[model samples]
Target: MAEEEISQISAGEFEAVSQLLSSSESLQLAFIIMILGIIGIVFGYRKFSSWVGSQKFYYKRPHFSRFVRRAVLPFFAIALITAINVHTQTGVLFGEISSIEDETISAHEQFAKILNTFNILVIGYTISHLVPIILTKREKSILEKEDFDAWFELRGFSDDSEDLFHKLYKWVPPNNAPEDIDEKEFQELLNTEKGRQYLEQFRTSKGNPIGGYEKLVDNPFEEWKKSERAKYEKYYQNCITGNNQSGRKLKPGTKPDEIFPIDVWREEKREHGYESLIPSSRPPGYAKKKREGLPKSAKQILPLGIFLATILAVVAWWGVDLIVLATATGGFSIGLGLALQETMQNYFAYIMIRKDKIFVEGDRVQLETGYNGYVHKITPRVTYIRDALNESIAVIPTRQLVNAQIVNYTKENKLVPAVVKVGVSYLNNPRQVASILVKVGKRGMREIVDTRGRHLVKQKRCPYLDKNKPSCGCDKELHVDATQPVVRFNEFNDSSLDFSMWLYVRDYGAQFKTKTDLRMIMYEEFKKYDIRIPWPIRTVYQGDEKKEFEEISELDPDRDKVIDEFGMGDIGRGEGDE
Candidate 1:
């Protein structure tokens, strides 16, 4: 597949196209066109020639002037040849074509043969014209991936260069220094160059004290997670559906304790007793109570008037041409199909949204296409989502939302279950690993709200006067079972013993932060226990010679350097330098 793509990219017009025209005259014309193309490539050398030398395909030199001369000029040249050949055959340049049959005339018949060759040349020209565009677009896509891979690999390396925490900050406190040092000793340390350096480090990057390096990699994965969390938080705050603590409001003058709570009805009963339920005013058919506008007989004839107007329109349309009628009918059918297709889909999607409770405003939802965001708004046609991954607004068609598998983080409850997976060396005891996980999980539990055993509090408190009424108890409360953090040994892979643990948190906003804390704590605990997070281990058996197995670094600086040189590194270098 790789070789085929390379071959396609390298393939070009000038030499390969000479065989497309068979006749001597047509062949000569094709040869002339090839020469012109060669001339264009030669003159545009400074613009695009550098692209040809690299072993990897050059998609295109994006200069409009160069592209026009190389890609567009050949098509024009072939078109001109075809036009002249057609004119020579029929002698109809800037004039009407002859209606008389010409196959009987020998000269006209021979001219027709030349015209056919020109047609072949024109088709060949069109193919040649399309090849560069198709190849260039595909090549550009591949190059973008290559550029991303290089950037991803270099992110940590570049961050290390900027990070002062490991290089200097960690040394500032001085190992085993006496905490009870006198003022004289403190002053002496302050006067030293190390103290000044420590102070200067604090001033760097606008008083960013620890200098762990501000997010050097613009990773989509991290951005997506952030956006998802932001969406969840927005939903958690604004959504009327789940975990709302505020109570619903009641209308004015309504009695809370009554079966029928309307104050007006109660007032009427108080004034007139049981007779209030029966109207005391004039009946519907009475002169004063009757509707004052159109006569009943005219109202009955209104439908006949509408039906006659429709019949007249049909009679007028019947007098139009059959061709016109057919065309109009076909066009209307097509237009109706196009409009109704989208409309019907949206209609069904709306039904699904309400039926399945797909999502509501402020709910964090991820589409099947991997676009996850807090639903900012749901309109008749499109659903607007505030993307969690990038903090951007994603407007998706309601129709598309119906087909997609929307993963709503806040669907079940505000608390999203989080899991941390780690693999330790096989040498470590399973029980020991489980114990460490529980310890880290407990540590992670600190400052994070545990949703387990938490219940959704009603938005409004019921009126005490109506406490015995069913309407007062209409508010539903949901309770979740209290769960302990669980650790499970999942799989024994080729390299390590994989284990996963589950933790519950109340706020989806703090989910990632909690995970990070757990991982960091686990790392420290693992180090203390002398348990290694193992790399993939492979064993190769040799027949005679004994070979030592060594772990290799994941990154190759030399390979990366070459790829970066060919990529958009120059553009990124300015930003990196800043």
Candidate 2:
């Protein structure tokens, strides 16, 4: 009975197919239009794909070319569909088709509208994909033009060292579990209590319980499934699959855990120890100059924004109702805004920082919060600062930088003035002390200019020299009078006359050393001239010296007994005593 019912249903479908084939001329015309539309779609796709493939840059990236071609195919299909719909309506209007079913025309129009909507989504996706690529290309061009050769070279060294480290220290499972047990099966087993019990039986090669398995058992599954664990699991899977294997082979006697000289060197390089050792490789002020020369972040962001806006415009043109879109997004927009309030503020602050030229990378700045450092990097949300006093990095929100007071030492000029104060005895000749102070200041200035001046000139950081002609001999005048050391007897203290010697150094980083040099020079010159730096001296007098002694002796009867114990017969005798 079931077989007979199926046969009846098949017959009905076959009769329907036959009826469609023998339908009116209008139906046949619609069928022909669809077939032609499909053909046009195929032809248009081929032409578009070929054009994309012919472009030199796009041709090199076949995957990207294919993605772009696939993305654009929906638009081509929609256009052909629209054409077919237009032709069909024209036929009906002119009576070329004696009659057409309203439902049939309606279905065709609906299908075309759906394709148009799909095409809008495809366009939006294509623009989103292209924006990053455009920004990356612009950034690469900008970096290429700037002097980041040292930074790039350092990065290359780091990558190579990391590669070498991985090779030297190959990762193995905690325990040498049966090689036959698939990692995937082991992970799946972890989900079940019985499976976990089974895994707990296997011991590590070291003859100890599996540490990782123990950790898994201790922590709740949900907590263990957080992002950090997920990342570790992914990394472990990659390691097990040999995806992270470096092709380099080990030396004849090298163990997997062996530390090599190259590894040590790489570690030092990572810590910037190598850069410090080879100062000539990295020009002074390289970070500062590179930051100054970098194209503004706006240059990268503005074009991407415009491109996205154009995509939105195309979506709007495709008959997406703005009122509906706004209403649908209103709640989502409010939630997102609340969630990203701090993020938005930071981004705006980053724009302000760049626009106002408040500070750049390598500028030594002290924030109102007493965070002093050189700006290492500037991102939309966070600014990384390398501490001036140590190797630590301070991560400051960009908004903090905008809202807080900052003292930027390298904003307008690299040269910064430093003062050294000294106190001389009041009896010492003020003019002579002043002369020695000025002399030491002059000597310190010469020493700095001679030692660091050449480097500053090379870095184009010399304040006295023209940036265009760094070797114009104009800097030589700085040694004589351009920025001569100034001396002022600024204060008079109770014990001494305080004098301040003011001098200028190349930059903030040099100020400390410069001050030290000047102090050492002053010490030597002061000793040579027999100038005394005084200390507090106090002299106290009581009523009269003899009377005070007599009163103290009378007050203390033990004084005579103390003198007799020391075998002194006469105690407290004066000059007139007999």
- Alpha-carbon RMSD, candidate 2: 27.1
Candidate models: Cα lDDT each: 0.47, 0.53
Please provide, for model 1 over 1-578, each residue's C-alpha lDDT reduced to its tens digit, 9 standing for 90 to 100: 43443334322222223232333454355446645654664555534444342211121123232344455444554655565665555554313222223334333344444445444544454444454545554664564455334333222112123432232222243333233444466556558776534432322112122223333345554443343234333322332233232332212112221111112222233333112232213222332222233123322445455555544443343342434444546655787889789877876786678678778776877778787678776665777888766668987888887767778877767656567899987666565567667666655554332243111211122221122211121022214543435677889988789988767654455467567767888898777656578766676734332211111112224323423333321222365483
> What TM-score do all the candidates reach, one by one?
0.30, 0.44
TM-score of candidate 1 versus the correct structure, residues matched by position: 0.30
Task: Output the lDDT of residue 31, model 1.
Answer: 43
How far residue 415's Cα lies from its native spot in candidate 2, in Å, is 3.5
Which candidate has the highest lDDT of all?
2
Candidate 2 residue runs with Cα over 4 Å from true position? 1-318, 376-386, 391-397, 449-482, 535-578
Clashes of 2: 0
